[model samples]
Target: MHVAVLGAGYAGLSTARRLESRLPPEVDLTVVNDGPDHVLVHEVHRAVRRPAVADAITIPLSDVLDRATVVDARVESVDAEAGRADLDAGETLSWEYGALCLGSETAYYGIDGLSERATPLKSLSDAAAIRERFLALCDAGGGQVVVGGAGLSGVQVAGELTALAEERGLAVPDDIEVVLVEQLEEVAPNFPANFRRAVREELTDRGVDVRTGTTVERVTDGGVETDAGPLAYDQLVWTGGITGDDATGGDRPTVRADLRLTDRTFALGDAARAVDADGEPVPASASAAIRMGKTAAENVGRLVDHELNGSADEFDPRLERYRFDVPGWLVSVGDGAVAQIGPTVLRGTAARASKTTVGAGYLTSVGAVHNAVNLAEEELL
Candidate 1:
């Protein structure tokens, strides 16, 4: 009666926590990942400009998973049919059921020099690397900076860099520029038009060059070579794309409504191409991931209970569908932000406060009260 949850990002942590509360006490639960702490994936961009905030946002897996075994190792591969997983340290885990929440890796869009030249903003290490590079650029008296992908991540990074430059004031180059490149016609395509416009306005107001409908042909050491023209920059940040793990790979079968890839296994978050009733792909947001994780965990509990009861095949428990109706999204630029919930879009300090409120609520949900308070203080103050 062992349940193994892989890769403890938002989806993994959420699933593991909910499963612990629902499953029988005797059911052994194991949560495995490369890091022992669950870092806030979404806030890593902010952490770049504010490094001290990382500690408060990251929660130790050991402290949170009192009912589960915590394994700190890279998961090399998982055999769903065999109910086994291979780890990087030459170890194996056998489980009766498995949930894949390995998340995703940055995608370079087949552009030349992008991977080598651009610094991605995804993990804690990535954020630290961005901070280091920015520091170097500042020390060198500042220079032009180009960021590819005007999605929320790109927008946030560009905004943060702009804020950082403003803090530096005249210490950096007066001619310094920050450009955001997006192939799409608008930023945050998934968001409503008003919200997108609001975010764009914020970027423009902060002196960010938002070039939409411009494709990056390739990245060069000196700058980004876009279809429109070549632009020189001292730093280039790529927040373009991501790809998921195997069972949720582009080459494999799509995830079912129950969030299952196989009868004994499930996939959630960026690891799966989860769709709604109309088969529309779900946005890869933290909110969606949390909801998907909860649904998947509930289904697993139902299956485990049925198995333990030795119920007949026809008497199987019902599985709930993954329902991710994310009310809205928020994008921050310095002390201000643009948030949308339902049909309403808001801006200014209120929006900024909304973002902090969401972060605090998430920390509370994950049983990190102290961390929540600290994050609230760091963000609000």
Candidate 2:
């Protein structure tokens, strides 16, 4: 039996690793990704301040997978009904079972000149470019640095930029004005009220000019055009929103708790808008993606067993359903961090430690033990 897994992000990598032990030795497992390495995307923001940390967050596929064939190519489209996936390299892969976890891309939201003007913090390259631009601005005697979108990514990058400026001997707000703008009423808008308040406090203490309820209408060469007024900036970084992968025509298709796109195909992670078994909307986060991947892997295993046994049963095998249950949330602001667990919200040293632990834990879970050690040393020490 041939099983193909698309994309090597958090979801795809987790599914592939679990499948190795679940499937039979004779089953051919292939993983297709645009890159050869799986990136700890949530930690990519750290690279914006410390470029050397990039290696600790990116793990090569060869180091983790024992039996899967890794195909490094972009997935152009997935025809689930046909059980075929077309690659950008002009090749097609046919599979008996498939898992689609292509992740997402930055959404410019049809804002004028935004796509061309703003640097997004979604990848290693994006982090590097943002660092370069910020450093150049500092060299030019400092100016306003505007960050569009006050989501987790935006808030993290804004904090990193402030730290970067201070490291370059620039005064916060005075020399380098770090402005964080959000259309919502508060930063980390989707999170709990207490967590949002803590994040805003940390950013404010770090000299970030927090602008809530400010909608960005357009982007111009000089600065950002917003509902409030024109906010001038020497550089702009956007972390506003994300859309589905291009393979799915930039739409996050709905998926049930089982994470199945078709009888023989599964879709999870940011590529699909998923609802849990209890009918709760699953938020697009690294933790959520990993959980969905695990659940999907088990369901895939059940299906494989049923087919191999040649079961004449009229109904398909009972598949495992995914539930959206996460322990907490964490976000870093400059040197400090914020963590929300249940009804409690924490900040300062405890929160910072929690944030570091989560990053290292994810690395270790992915079989990147060496990388995990390096990440811990870099983050904690």
Candidate 3:
């Protein structure tokens, strides 16, 4: 009569909250994660320009969870079959039902010197470091800043860097040499055509050099080694690849249709290779993770009820599967942004508003109204 959820990211938080609302009062629940507060991973990029935004984007776990034990400890691994999770501090937690929603980390791809040379944008500390280092470079007479990804995060980081340079009166594209390198031929490979074009235009307008169809082969202290050639840069950031950290999160284990790695143990989010009703692999994104987390929570609740009732029947509860849907896409680039919500594609004020609304909506859903309101005020004002 217990359910344990791991990590406090989008998937874990959503699952825990939904479980609290659905599970019976007798059931004990525990949430194990590495941190006390939930971070808005997407908003971490903006902290580069507005450092105070880091505070507004994080909410203490106790501020949201109503009835659950929140364990702020690093989980080493989960023996799903054994129903036990090992912690980094030589402790183990046992559970009847569990959900593994530990998120992803940067993938350095075994490229020589890349891990040591390239900075990653996977955490709040990464963003904060970028902010600090970028300013330091500016004060040291500014040089080339190369971003090794043209994805949403990379575009946003490049945009923020561009704005920060302009704010500090650093040279636009010349002295800074802010370049966004993408392996694909387009800026946003998976986005709509119009949105892709819009992002490219915005980067161009913001004086960011956009290099398409370029592959980064290695990283050096001086710059990135790519298929094109050695591109000189003072600071290099990698935002292109992501993979599950197996030691922290579980390995990408095969899960049953109900997302069960073992009986009473479920795996969701980036840590699991999840599929939908049609058996197609679901892509990892915050939106997908949130939806999958709720589904997993509901299924876990059903299993708990079956166990407590001690049903004589087969006790095969019908489980819900995640249905993939493009719930729209929004990318904010400094003062402007572009969004494609359903059939509508927008830019400028409409897009910026849409982006802000999505962010505020996420914060509101997690019961961080004060932080949401303050973020809005800080962003707008």
Which candidate number maximizes TM-score? Answer: 2
TM-score of each: 0.95, 0.98, 0.95
lDDT of 3 at 28: 95
Q: Is candidate 1 or candidate 2 better by lDDT?
A: 2
TM-score quality measure for candidate 3: 0.95
lDDT string, candidate 1, 1-381, tens digits = 899999898899999999999999989999998888998888888887888889888999987788889999988878877788888899999888889888887888689999999989888888889888887887777888888988878999888887887776633236567888999999876777999999999888888888999999987779688889998988888998777654334332368678887878898888877876556778788888888888989989999999988884656588888766887999898667999988899999889999999998999888899999999998888
Ranking by lDDT: 2, 3, 1
Q: What is the lDDT of residue 138 in candidate 2?
A: 94
Task: Name the lDDT of candidate 1.
Answer: 0.85
- In the range 1-381, model 2's lDDT, one tens digit per residue, is 999999989899999999999998879999999999999999999998888789999999999998999999999988987789999999999998889999999999999999999998899999999999999999999999999999999999999989989999999999999999999999998888999999999999999999999999988897799999999988999899999889989988899999999987999998889999999889889889999999988988888888888882657888889999899999998889999988899999999999989899888988899999998888888
Model 1 segments more than 4 A misplaced = 171-174, 245-253
The worst-scoring run of ten residues by lDDT in candidate 3 lies at 248-257
Where is model 1 poorest over a 10-residue stretch in terms of lDDT? 244-253
Error of 2 at 250 (Å): 0.9
Best by lDDT: 2
Query: Over the stretch 201-288, how does candidate 3's per-residue lDDT look in tens digits?
Result: 9889889999999999987789688999889988888888777766544256656457877886888877777877778777667777
